[model samples]
Structures are given as C-alpha cells and as structure tokens.
Target chain A: MRKLSRSSGDVGKKITETIEAVSEAIEDTLVVSRKFARQDEETLGNAERIIDSVLRRFSRAASGLTESEELLRTENNAINYEISDVFVALQFQDRVSQILALVCDDLNKLEQHLNELKSQQADEGSSRSVNVEQWLEELSKTYTMEEQLTAHDGTKAEIKTDQPGITFF
Target chain B: MAKTILFVEDSASVRQVMNSTLTREGYDVILACDGQDALTRLDGSKIYLIISDVNMPNMDGLTFVKSAKQMPAYKSTPIIMLTTETQEVKMNEGKAADVKAWIVKPFQPAQLLAADSQLIQA
Candidate 1:
C-alpha cells in the first residue's frame, strides 16, 4: 500500500510539469502574433505617408503649370499691343513720300526756269537777271505743310499735338 | 451689298495698307495709283465714297474732286482728302472743292475708321 501511494505522487508531479510547459507555449504564440501585427501597422502607415507626399507633389506641379499659362497669356497680349503700335508708326512713310514728291516737283520747276533763263540770255546777248523775289514767292506758294514752311525759314519745326487734324465741312 | 469705296493715292504702300484696313472693315475697295487713274474707275458705277491724296503724279486731288463733282453719276458723292498738307490755304482749297473731310498723314487707322463711320452708314 505504501508503494502504491509513492507512484501516485510521482504521476501528480509529472502532470504539473506538463501543464507549466503548455502555459509557456501559449505565451510565446501570443508574443509572436503581437509582433507581426505591429509590423503590419508600420508598413501600412509608411505606405499612406508615401502616397500623401506624391499627391502633394502632383498638386504643386499642376499649380505651377496654371501660373505659367497665365504668364504666357499676358506676354502674348503685350506683344499684340506692341505690334499694333508699330503698324500705326509705319504710316509715317506716306507723309515722307509726299514731302519728297513735292521737293522733286519744285526741283523740276527750278530746272525748267533756269533752262528758260539760259535761252533768253542766248537770244538777247544780255544778262537779264532772274526776279529773285518773284521766284521766292512762287516757291513759297508750292509749300503745303507747316513743317515745310518752318524748314524753309530755317526755324525749329513745331511740336505736333496729340490731337489729330480732322475737319468736317 | 457691300459699299464700294474709291481709294486714290500715289504711294503704293499707303494704298496697300488702306486697302487692307478698309477691306477688313467689310467695305469693297477700288484702288487707284493717282488722281488720273481714279477717274478711269469712275465709269458711271455706284461709288459710296472717294478718298484721295492731294499731291499725286498725273492729276492732283483738288482737280480730281472738281472733275468728279461735274460727273452726273458721282456729283453728290462724298469726298475725303487724305494728305500731308496742313496749311490753311490748302484746307481752304479743299473746302472750296466741296470735300467732305480732311485727314492729315500719318493718320491713325482708328481715326480713319471713326471718320468713315461718321460719313458712311453701316
């Protein structure tokens, strides 16, 4: 009967050891599961931050493009305005041509008058002087512009006002 | 129907520019190199307006105006003198010729267009 009690005590000790080992295994499994869950959360957070950074960069690029487009539009408008001014300025060619033509006509008349004077001198064999005052008056009558008069008088040309000369009769 | 305008000028460049400007505003333009050339185009056709230059090679603008006024077809046609002349004497001559308006060069396109609008109905 004493032998039987000793065996039963030994079986009880073995059962306690088995229960302790099972408890340790369960604790290890729970730590490993917690570590894996924390890694997954970190990876998800990093992915979200990277996505947010890329989106912000895309937004900034779009804003820059819009600004550049507006600047180009303003520049284009300014260029168009300048071109129109150039066209207006080019109209001076017509005035210059007219003035030059008048000068040419006067020169032709002077040549003809000189030729006539030479013929008269050859025929009369005497120098009949040209009427300087009459010639000058005739020359003055051909002038059409205030600038031309001022040029003939050796005076400074008058500054033209911004008001255009438009007369309605 | 688009109104026909007779544009007479000695300068080729001025004629080209004026032609472009007038045609852009939807007016039919008949170009002439000088006053004498302009008279040839006056062949009894309907002319809405006549724009002429004063100093031209064959015939001058004032003479052209006087001749045009004598024509039975274009006697009452409106005339405008476009020239570099700014003297009162020339202006008086133009007035005597029954010129409707006088515009000095270098003229602004906008000013010319404005004057055109005043004289011509849309």
Candidate 2:
C-alpha cells in the first residue's frame, strides 16, 4: 500500500536516482583511490550496463510519477466540482428557513390581530365595531416581501418557488 | 490582488459556508448579520462587491440596497442581492438603487462567480 502525498510523486524517482548516482560516484572514487589495483575492463563494462539498466528504470519510474500527478489532479478537480455543486445545493436550507420565518411572521401578526379583535369586542361590551375586513387589510400590511404577498393572493396561479435571477436591467 | 466582498446574510451557517468558498478563491470576505449591520460594515473601504440577503431582522434587502446606495463610497459598487424573494417590484427597486445583479437563494457557485467576475474588475 502506497500513501500518496503532495511530494510523494517525486520521492520514488529522487530516491532511486540519488542512490544510483552516489553508488556510481563511490565506485569510481574507489577505483581512482586504488592506484596499484589491477584494471578489470570486462567487470567495469558489466557494472556500467547494470547501472545503465537501473538508470533507465529510474527514468521510467519518474515518467510514471508525472503521469500519476496528472491523473491525481484530474480526479481532484472532478471531486471539487461535485463539492461545489453540493455546496450550491445546500443553500436551500437558507431559502427554506427564510420562507418558514416569513410564515411564522404572518402567524404572529394574525394572532396579534385576533387578540386586538377580542380586546375591541370586550371593551365595546359586545361585538359591534370589529370590522374583520379592515383587520385583514392591516394584516396584509404586515406582509412585506413578495412571497408573503403571493401567499395572500387568492388565485389559481401557482407560486413561483424557484429563485430567479435578474441580471440585465 | 485579491478582491474584497461584503456578504450580508442573517444565517450564520450559510455565512460560514459561503465565507469558506469565497475565501478559498482568494477573495477577502466581510460579514454582516443584517442590513443595519451591513450599513455599519460600509466604512469607506474599497469593497469590490456585495452579496446580501433579502429578509433580515433590522432591515430587509431592498431597503439595505437603497441605504447602501446613499453612501457616496458605495453608490456604484457592484451589489448582488441573494435571497428567496422573486418579485418584480422588489427587483425594480433594487435596479433603481443601482443593484446590477439579483441572485436567488440556493444559487450555484458558478452562477455567483460568473456574476461577480462580470461585475468586479481585476
């Protein structure tokens, strides 16, 4: 199992290349230090081929790392777009909350209006000066926003629940 | 240079989420809980844009836009009203107040960003 990190993509190539380069440098230094040692051309040639093969593999591994980084970035962008969409959708909570709050506001106003009606009747010693239509008109004043007005509009027209934008004039 | 956006919303949770999204995109965000609070926030800073909610405790969105336009510094600033109200009368009032954009609630980020990019300069 490989744990992916921001820099992990470069780790494999760097580690392999660094180890190979150091080993070659150390071997060449050893050869140079042994001044009186017998020169083995065949052994040295074999060592060169082996190092070349390792270096080629390291290069391929590095290329693979670049490919992996590209893939990871593509996937990340896709998830981010989805997350962005989700965040956008989540704003419905605010919309619904606003509507409910207005509904509650209407209810509170209605209750107050009813209480005033009862008080007027009680003060008059009978139900005489209580005009329900006038109270209804006053109730409409409590409703300010369009949604509240729409709810009060008695008609067959369906209320537009979707939020529409007006960008141009 | 990062642009500063004033977001006037009553819902704290919505503000937090929107703040995260806008700030992640390198925009400096100033928050206001209502229209009155939003009024206090407009202290002569060079605000790039404003995103406001319609229904609030102290003052509603249309009134806020009108009040914001009264401030000489923010009269022509790009204002986007974000709310659930979809009435033509209210929108007309907003237009009169120099609000160029009106975004409905539950709006997409791309929609908002597009409006912002179109309105806000570099």
By DockQ, the best candidate is 1
lDDT string, candidate 2, B32-120, tens digits: 99999999999999999998988888898778888888889998788898866666677787788788788766666767878887888
In terms of lDDT, the poorest run of 10 residues in model 1 chain B is B104-113
For model 2, residues A3-104, the per-residue Cα lDDT tens digits are: 576468689789999999999999998888674344566678879999999999999999999999999999989987886667665666666566577668
- Assess every candidate by TM-score: 0.64, 0.68
Classify candidate 1 by CAPRI docking class. Answer: acceptable
DockQ of every candidate: 0.43, 0.41
RMSD vs true structure, all candidates: 9.6, 19.9
Q: Lowest-scoring 10 consecutive residues by lDDT in candidate 1 chain A?
A: A80-89
True contacts kept of each: 0.70, 0.65
Q: Model 2 off-target regions past 4 Å?
A: A1-60, A63-71, A123-166
